[model samples]
Target: MSLLDRFEQAFMPNYGVPPVALARGEGTRVWDVDGKEYLDFIAGIAVSSLGHAHPALVEAVSRQVATLAHTSNLFVHEPEVLLAEKLLGLLGAPARVFLANSGTEANEAAYKLALTYGRREGRSYFVAAENGFHGRTIGALSLTGKKSIRDQFGPFPVDVRFVPYGDAEALRRAVTGDCIAVFLEPTQGEAGVVPPPEGYLRAAREICDATGALLVADEIQSAIGRTGHWFAHQADGFVPDLLTLAKGLGGGLPIGACVGFGAAGTLFGKGDHGSTFGGNPVSCAAALAVLDNLDLDHVNAVAPRLRSGLESAAHPLLKGVRGRGLWLAAVLTEPRAAEVQRAAAGAGFLVNAVQPDAVRIAPPLVVTADEIDALVTAFPKILEEAAQ
Candidate 1:
């Protein structure tokens, strides 16, 4: 039997089957089991910021696993403390950290932080951006504003108010004293790399402060140099009381973190929140390696180059390109974003259909100018064929 056939009978059909079975990867490229090479622009849904098999990440994980892999939460590991210090330094905030295993777990950590923050006074409500994607878990899903995903999930945990994204006024009014916090993505990745208007974040910060609500920035897709910023909330100078991170933090391995600043940092006392596998030495080591390689100067320098390459495009299929740094979207004229993604793959590129009419690009910061040129060169033809 074929590998796919054998797998179907053996494993649960959770993710069904991936279209391609990857055997190996290096830098910005991956090869399927059949040995067909493809430029990996998806970056594992924005998870592989440094690309597959980056030396730093591999070495870090290997070293940690070889030395001390799993130590229970009962013992404090040096890697965890070091990672916390690194993250706090990066954010330039006095904060406390809770490590987790995925984006959902990171948001779950944030949820607990919100609950703790809300327990004070009388606030127990949460406000989320409409069409937002938080996580699949119950608590995070409760705050996720996507109706299609939530409707099937049934009545969510508690009070969740969904408001139009990017509308500061709408968000301001929605988050009152009864609200614990507002969850927002700097650039809505799944919703198509949509960046809020300038001053919007600052305005939201003001409202949250006035109402005694915490501002939570979900940087799962936008952080870790994807947008040439350490944290997306820093773009507008908004220091969120709570911050959630995952995706690129581990370079490729799974890792997540919920960061609480100032008073929010002390919201949860001992025994309030805990995770068994979070802050595992291996994951922390991998994340530290990612940080070591992804220095601010280097990642920041790549942003303008990526923006310039996409912004100059004048094609029939493309409306415009939007986003920051290496994270961007090629807004399409048609809702056939999936077709364009497939065609790009056939043309030796790998992009994503983030929305029906937007193709998102969250390639590794290490992507070369010539590779981008290759993308730009093939882009017009890729769209033309997709048009067929």
Candidate 2:
């Protein structure tokens, strides 16, 4: 049977059975089962930081899996310890790390940490932005701003208040004394790579301070060198009390982390929480290689070229481009992003129509100038075809 055929029979229908079945990948490219190659702009939705089949990641994961694959939370392991230390070093902050298996799990742990911190102080309300996408778990979903996804899963256990993203006044009004924490994304990713106004995070910090609420920054899609910084919040020169991370941290392996700073670091008690396969040693090894190969200098150097190339394409269908570093969105003049995506795929490139009018481009950090130029060259034609 064909791969998609097997997938439909075995797996849940949540993903709707994509058309192509990828057989192999190398660098910033992939080939479907029939051996048609395409440039990968989605990069596993920003999870493949070092690209597919990276030697470093392969070797590290191989060596670690041969040595030690997993040790539950009941025991300690070096890869986990080393990875935790490495993450803290990258953050350049004194914090404690809790490992999980994916972005949702990371946000779930962070939510619990916030709840634990809040319950101690008798605060019960949680605040988040209107368009922010956190995760799929119930509590995290409650904090998520999109009504279409969240409203269906009614009667979430927490009292969550929603405010307009990038509006400091709206956030300030919502974070009253009853509020426990304010969950936010430094840049809203799934909402078509939307970045807030300058100094917005600093404003959040100030507001959190005034209300004695924790500032929890969801860095799941923007951190780990995706945005020319180890963490996106670092570039803005302020620190969130709690940070949730996943995607790209483990290269392609599944891993996540909930990092807590200052008093928040010690908020979880003995019986507070735990994960069974959260700190799998193989995943940590993969993360180490990913971190080593990231090379911020190269990313910073290449990013502007990519951005300017897309902006200078000068197609009538192009509205504009926005985002920081390698994470970018090409805004279309019309609401035909899905058509543009299909056109790009037909032309041997892959991109994401994250919204009706936005195509999100996030290739691996190892993506070269030539690969970006290929996308830029093909994009105008792709847009033209989509317009038809």
Candidate 3:
């Protein structure tokens, strides 16, 4: 049988079958098994931060794997400790870090931390924004606000209150003294890269402080310099009590972290939690390379050029662009995002139709000006064909 057939037979149907089976990738481009090359805008769903096969990432993983790969939570390793220290430095706060394997696991750790911290103060109710995507795990899913996914996985551990996203008054109303924590994404990724109004994060911080609830920032998609900033929350100039990270944390390998700042840092004692493969040396090494190579100055310079390129479009199918930095969404005038995705693929470009009317683009930090120009120049034609 063929490779696609083999994939279909062996893997679960959760993601369905991907249209293309990529063979190899370098820089911002990937080649399929049949030798068809395409610009990769998805960046492995925002995980491949430094792009595919970056030399720094490659060397770090290779060196670490050849040296030491795994160590259970019982023993401490240099890479893990160093990565934790680097992350704390980047966060610029007094915090404690718990490493995990993925975004779900990070959020799960954060949830438990919040629970334990809340129980200490006699609060258990939780709050999250509507349409937010956390993860598939039970505790993370319980915090996710998407009904379609939540309904299928019934009987969650606890019911979490949901309010309209980007509405500060609603958030304030929902998060009272009884509420233990509030989970929020600075910019909603799955819901089409929607950025909240300015000062919204500050408001959440203030409200959580007043109510004595923990402000948990879920930066799974927004952190790691995905935006121009090291941490998107830093742009708002406020520190969160708890922060969860994954996606680009390891550049490509799997790694996640739940960091608690100040008082939240003291919540977990011995025997609180552990993960066998969470802090693998190779993954931590890869994460350090990613951090080392990520150039925030380049990101700050190129992001606006990308945003302007999309916003300047005058096509009938194009509506406008939304989001910050390298993370952006092309809003369509009609519900033809799927058709647009297909057309873009046919034109040797890969984009994601995250919503019926939105296409998301999260290219690697190393994407050059010419690549951005190519996509911008091709977008009008791509949309016209989709409309046809």
Candidate 4:
């Protein structure tokens, strides 16, 4: 039997059988076992901020594994401390960090902190926006407003109130003195890269402050230069009380962090919450390498060029483009996004059907202009096929 066949036979059905087994990657490109190259715009669902096999990530992972890999939560390691420091520095406020393994885990940690903080302080309910996706876990999912990802996983941990996103009036009306936190993604990634109206984040922050509730920002998909800003909320000049980060935090390695600022920072005390592999040295070191290799240059110069290249490509099926920096969504007239996604893959440019009529294009920060141009050149053909 073939390797894929053997794997399919052994494993339970979950993600379904993938079409191709990717062998390895370099920069913004990956190859199947058969050595067919694909331009990777998906970037592992926005986790590969610096692209695959980046020298910085490679070196850091190697050095850390060669030295020290894992230690107990009772102990502190340099890489973990450094990674925490780096995250805090990017944050405008002095913050405390709790690390986890994925975006959902990070949001779970945040929810726990918020609930604990609110319960101790006499608040009970949490307010989240419609179509807001925090994660899959019960606590996080409870806060998630999208029914499709939640209805099956019923009886969640906490009671949550949902409001329409990007509407200040909805937020103001929903949030009351009994609310614990108002949670939202600055730019809703799973909602077809929907960016909230300007000043909405600040409005939410204000409402949270007035109601004595924490404002939680889920920057997991948009942070670390995904949306042309370190934290997507930063672009709006709103500071959140609790921030959940993952996806691109470790630059492809699994790592997540919940950063609580000001008084919210100390919500989780000793013995409150912990993780075994939360601050694993290798992952933290890899994250640091990713950070070192990406910064302002990625935001100002490279992202715009890539955006232009993508925007430069036009087709009858494509209606418009939206998003900031490298995080972009190509709006199409038809809802056959999955078909276009297959077409993009067939054309050697990997894209995501993030919504019914939208394809998300979030390439690595290291994606060159020429490579982007190549993808653009191939995209029209896919769009044409999508038209069919």
Q: Which portions of model 2 miss their true places by more than 4 Å?
A: none
Q: Rank by lDDT, descending?
A: 2, 3, 4, 1
State the displacement of the C-alpha of residue 235, model 4, in Å, after optimal TM-score superposition: 1.0
Pick the winner on lDDT between candidates 1 and 4.
Answer: 4
Total clashing pairs in model 3: 0
Q: Residue-pair clashes per candidate, as listed?
A: 0, 0, 0, 0
Model 1 — which ten-residue stretch has the worst lDDT? 295-304
lDDT of 2 by residue, 31-82 (tens): 9999999999999989999999999999999999999988899999999999
Model 2 residue 24 CA deviation in Å: 0.8
| lDDT per residue as tens, model 4, 132-152 | 899988888998988988889
Candidate 4 yields a Cα-based lDDT of 0.87
TM-score of 3: 0.99
User: Is 3 or 4 the stronger prediction by lDDT?
Assistant: 3
- TM-scores of all models? 0.96, 0.99, 0.99, 0.97
Output candidate 2 Cα RMSD.
Answer: 0.9
Off by over 4 Å in 4: none
